[model samples]
Target: MSTTELSLAGSQPGGLGRYNRQAADLHYVTSRVMVYLLAFTAVSVIGFPLFWMVICSFKTSTELYQFPPAFLPHDWTLTNYRDLFIQTNFPIYFVNSLVVAGGATLLSLVVGGLGAYSLSRFKFAGMRTVSMLTLLCYMLPEVLLVIPLYLFVVDLGMADTLISLIIANTAFTLPLTMWFMRSYFNAIPASLEESAMIDGCSRFQAMRKVTLPLALPGLVSVGVFSFNHAWNEFLFALVFTSSETKKVLSLGLATWIGQDNIYSWGMLLAGAVLVTIPVVLFYLLVQRRLVVGLSEGGVKGE
Candidate 1:
């Protein structure tokens, strides 16, 4: 063959090579389409219930009980919300939820922060075992823990109290808070705290002045997670509190549903809407920090 013909033949793609390239491109496009489809499906599944609840909250009682339920209310009204706030013990329940969730979150963060700092920065024996146990505790289901916790609360004479709810929430949340903060602390540079220590600062002062500020994103993420968890917790609240006056929103709203009686479907939906607002608002406020903190934790091998 002439040199030109030989070169041309060498440059031409083999049949297998061309087939492989086409297969890879097809696979790539198919994977992308499947990912987008799954994401859309997940959003619809999770978001539809929330959207429906809000829509029902605005519906009139007649429309709510109509033969075929309407997607959009023909007669929109705030009557449910008005009744929820005015007629029921909803306000008291809301306040109780706030106190318990807030107190639990505060206590979790304080103890978890210090515990995480110790685990990340110190070099004591059984440290690895302690870390593993913290993760195990967090991973365990609340159902498994509630029985013993209920008995403990009764022994302490704290059942049916808001403080008991707070203590219960804190006990469950503190483990996860410790795990998250431990990862975050691992990602932080130790030199920052060391420099503070060299400047006549005690260990606590170094943590307060230097380390804590650096880990603000992680702290915010953990705080929001703890608060949201406590807010949504139902089993602990149900087991701990009995009186209507002491009930949190979760337990209180549950009583609206019964075998023969639904106190008010409209008001039940309204309460659900109200229950979601604080958590959604709190998330929106610190969403950026949550994203950054979690992303950095992964990148840093935590």
Candidate 2:
């Protein structure tokens, strides 16, 4: 008799299960192929407009209005970009946007990181309530708060001030950032914090040396989220800022269109392309860290 162990409890070793296994493997492969195809389709649909806008940016105004649309420029020109620079306050709006968004992001990361560390590491009365309420606060829509926020800023004579915009953006961003960071912190073992504390480190020092380094990805992710929140913000800036010099990109871009006529379509598309580049560039720079942040922040990661 053969001495080798029977495979799959069949009469023969390593050969009894071929027919069923082969069919099942083929089905699994087919399913995976379908999944890949579906994902590719979804990605293509989502990215098409960005590609279309870029193509439109290079087309002449007359070409842009042509029927049946052209994907490639029959006659491309830099006129739109030139007009954007010369005729619009895009430069100041870009600078204001840079300052306001950068400042707000920095402020949110600082406050939120500290709050997250505290909430995750230390226990206190009403802590759970505060955690739950913080998320609820983020859920409070920007539209709902715009009226009160505008009144409050105007009363302080901060209308059109970048500081007002920065503060408002930071306030809107902080609660969510803290919660995101705190969830990440919760996943990190408390023992790590304890070890740092024992090694001549204050709680803050421990965070700086031990926790923060490990949580850099989470930091980057939250930073990206906060940056995007502060950057694209429209309603607050619209209602609060009135001066041409103070306007951010989202509002400033509106001036490209006149009440009576559509502005240069090519130039408008060009402006959009320029506005999109920075955020996309920022994400590309930090995408690796952002992935780590999301994965590490949740309990899903070890």
Candidate 3:
């Protein structure tokens, strides 16, 4: 055969070799696609209820309760939202939730960050033991602590106040906040603090200037987590407060739910959708910090 013909012939694969290679590539691509498809399917399945409720919030009362309840409304209206704003204390509940969650989250950051710093940096007798005990506190159920907390709040004259809820939520959230902050801080070098000390910076100033900037992402994660816990908290609010005016968004939703008025699904859904906006905004804003913190959060303490 000619050299050109031979070269061309050699370039063509035997059927079995080509088939095997093609099959292997196909298998790899198929598996990767399958993994992605499964994850997307799972998310869609999980998200469908929230999606349906949000869409239903735009429907009329008659349309919402008709037979099987429409999946997508033929007649979308603003009436349900109008009624929700006019007839309910949703705005008040929103404000109450914001204040309590904001207060608890901020407190957790300050207390937890300091505690985490102490635990990570200073070695003293019973430090490990104290940390272990705090870790246990993280596992302790809120329900178990309810009676004592209720009595304590009542004694302190804060039983129905937002401050009472903020304190209770902070107590539980602090340990978790401490652990995460400690882990993040542990990843930082001790010399950074020592150098600041050499430069006439106090321990507090060192932490405030050098460490705090680096640890901010961790602090943001801690704050967002604590805020979520305080905002959506139900049991304590349910048990501690009797006054409707003191009710949070979580408790207010339950008040909207009555046996005789199941047709208020539109109103309920509208409220739910409204409640989600602030949290979604929060997540969007802090999402960048979360990525940066968690990325650098794992390293051995020097």
Candidate 4:
């Protein structure tokens, strides 16, 4: 071949290689931009309502009703929160919600951890059926179960008490906790517990030391779920309790929605903001564990 032709051929190959590299770099940059855009959109969608709620809570009743609602309050005030605390029974409602949610979360974790351990470790007749039935119970509508549960509570003489609310919440949340924890337990090798037993630990001790620690993520996830559910629940709170003192945050908030009288938008918004704070704080605290737990639990189990 001629020397000029040979040089041109070599240059063409290098030029083509450069084009391919440029194309790949462009593609990577485009993908990253798209992903970031999508993430920003999602965060804005989820966070804007919360931001609005917090902002409006600080607004006066007059400002809240003004045309073309302002994004930021011109006159920031604590009157709504002050009224919620002093003029209403919101503190009592907050305490009731805390008590019920905390009790239910604790009950669910203990009972669910033990039950999940049993279902994970033991193989017996109808074990699969029992597990399926547990999930089915969770899937049952709240309205369907309310009457039966109310009747049960009445019979036990626990009606109109926080204990009834706790028991009711536990009943609803326990199944999900058991199913989720069971997956975590099944992912953990039985040999680890066996090894602990060989080292003079009792079965319960082995569980406390070996199994529970490994399953911490799952526990955090379910504890958060149970607490969130119980804290936000309104149906059971309405049906099972009648007194103002026994009311929870959800029911208490509903009282502000007047049939004949005007709604207290400021106080209502303030209550909503307060109601959301604990769940947000709890999630923020355990978010790392929650993410790991959900991913591991879903992927590792049979």
Candidate 5:
């Protein structure tokens, strides 16, 4: 054979080579199919309960108790929602939850942000020990600290108040916030803040204007986490608060569960839906910032 023909023949795959290529292609396709299947299954597992909750909220009490429960409601009604608003103290619980969550989020952000900034920017004695301790505190179970926290609140004569809940939530969430924000702050260059300070801004001013703006994503992430934790917290609310007026949404919802039977599944579901909306909305609102923040952090790490 000519040299050109010989070279072309050598370059081309033989029968076994072609079969190997086919095998690789088959493997790739199978992997992709499995990945998609797993993704769909995970989404379904997580999303179905939420979907069912919303659907059942619209169901009638009679339909809710029906055997062989339907996936979708047969008789749609807003009675659950109406009763949640008019008949129950849901509005009060909602307002209390909002206040406590908001207050905790703000408090955690301020205290944790400053602490994180200090850890990131300054060299201090016991800094490593402090960081480790913070992580350990966060790792501790809520159940362990509930009694101590309740006693502390009572000692202050702040039990059964919304402020006590805020303080408790802040303390619990602060460690996580500090750890997370510290990482984010470390990812951000201190030179940026230094430059601001050199340009006539005070250290605090530089942090407020430059570092904080850059750390917006971290702040938003921790804020959302703190708010969600406080909002959904049942143990603290149950132990610390006593009065009906002081109850949060999580505590209020628990009252609907009678000893023998549920008071009203539809109304409870409706309240659950309402309780979930603010957290969802808050996440949706900050979704863009979160994506940007993650992308920026990844790029910085690289």
Candidate 6:
């Protein structure tokens, strides 16, 4: 204590404070630099594959199959894309994917939104059990459920149809939509809806007029989620629809990898680019709302 007091007394009051401030500033700067470094590293790792795919998509067949593959295209060409559209049933696949994904997203939103609202707003016996079951179903892997789903579809004689794909995708996506919307609906204050009801509006009208407007962000986020999930789904598309005309984008893309020298690598790369565009555009459109909804929902639910 005597030594400490002596040392403290020897140093100017302002000098110690200044030194401490300098150390803190140094530490903060170092931490910021480290964070930035990690972020850059992560981005580079995650983004490299997509970047390479785009690069390869532009490369000619000869350049693509080159022994020492060039990082940049030796001969850039749009031939792959031209062939993809002209030579393949890519357009049909694209439309199939769009229809299935869109239908699933729309259906998930309608059913899941109502279910979520009920779960969020109403209290009943077994509600907690039901919530847990919904989460459990979502947590289960798609592969595990596929066989039973296949048999069920077969029994219903809906196999090899777009309706089957829509039904399958909706079933899987609905639980997530319900849970996500439940969290979001929970975040929204009940007073807004109640006040509308107090103003001579029915509960349904109040929900339509007040709550739905406020839940737009959450809805957009869920829609994006459902659409993406449906778009990228391959297993169900592969197993359920064996017919060429009924195949979705993912199944169509797999055809590019032939057993012999029958397939076009360049066209496959081009297809990858084409497949990515819509999802990216959709994400960019509602990213702000998605971020807000997720953050608010996360905090409010817990």
Question: What total of clashing residue pairs does each candidate reach?
Answer: 0, 3, 0, 0, 0, 0
What is the clash tally of candidate 4? 0
Model 2 weakest 10-residue run by lDDT: 1-10
lDDT of 4 by residue, 92-161 (tens): 9999999999999999999988999999999999889988877777778999989999999999998899
TM-score of each: 0.82, 0.82, 0.85, 0.84, 0.83, 0.85
Candidate 4: residue 131 lDDT (0-100): 84
Tell how far residue 87 is off in model 3, in angstroms.
0.4
- Which pairs clash inside model 2? 184-297, 217-293, 218-293
Ranking by lDDT: 6, 4, 1, 5, 2, 3
lDDT of each residue in 1-302, candidate 5, tens digit only:
36644564477767755665677679989999999999999999999999999999999998888989998888899999998898789999999999999999899888998998899889989999998788777778889989899889999999899999988887778987887788889989999989998899999899899998999878888788778888888898999997989999999888777721645888889988988889899888778666654443233345
Candidate 4, residue 169: the lDDT equals 88
- Candidate 1: give its CA RMSD in angstroms: 5.4
lDDT of 2 by residue, 5-30 (tens): 23443663455556656776799899
lDDT of the structure predicted as candidate 3: 0.83
Q: Residues 242-274, candidate 1, lDDT per residue (tens digit)?
A: 999999998888877762144678999999899
Question: Least lDDT summed over 10 consecutive residues: which range in candidate 5?
Answer: 293-302
Compared with the true structure, model 4 gives a TM-score of: 0.84
> Best candidate, lDDT-wise?
6
lDDT of each: 0.86, 0.83, 0.83, 0.87, 0.85, 0.87
- Which candidate do you rate higher for TM-score, 1 or 3? 3
Per-residue alpha-carbon lDDT of candidate 3 for residues 138-170, written as tens digits (9 for 90 to 100): 778888998899999989888788888888888
- TM-score between model 5 and native: 0.83
Clashing pairs in 3: none
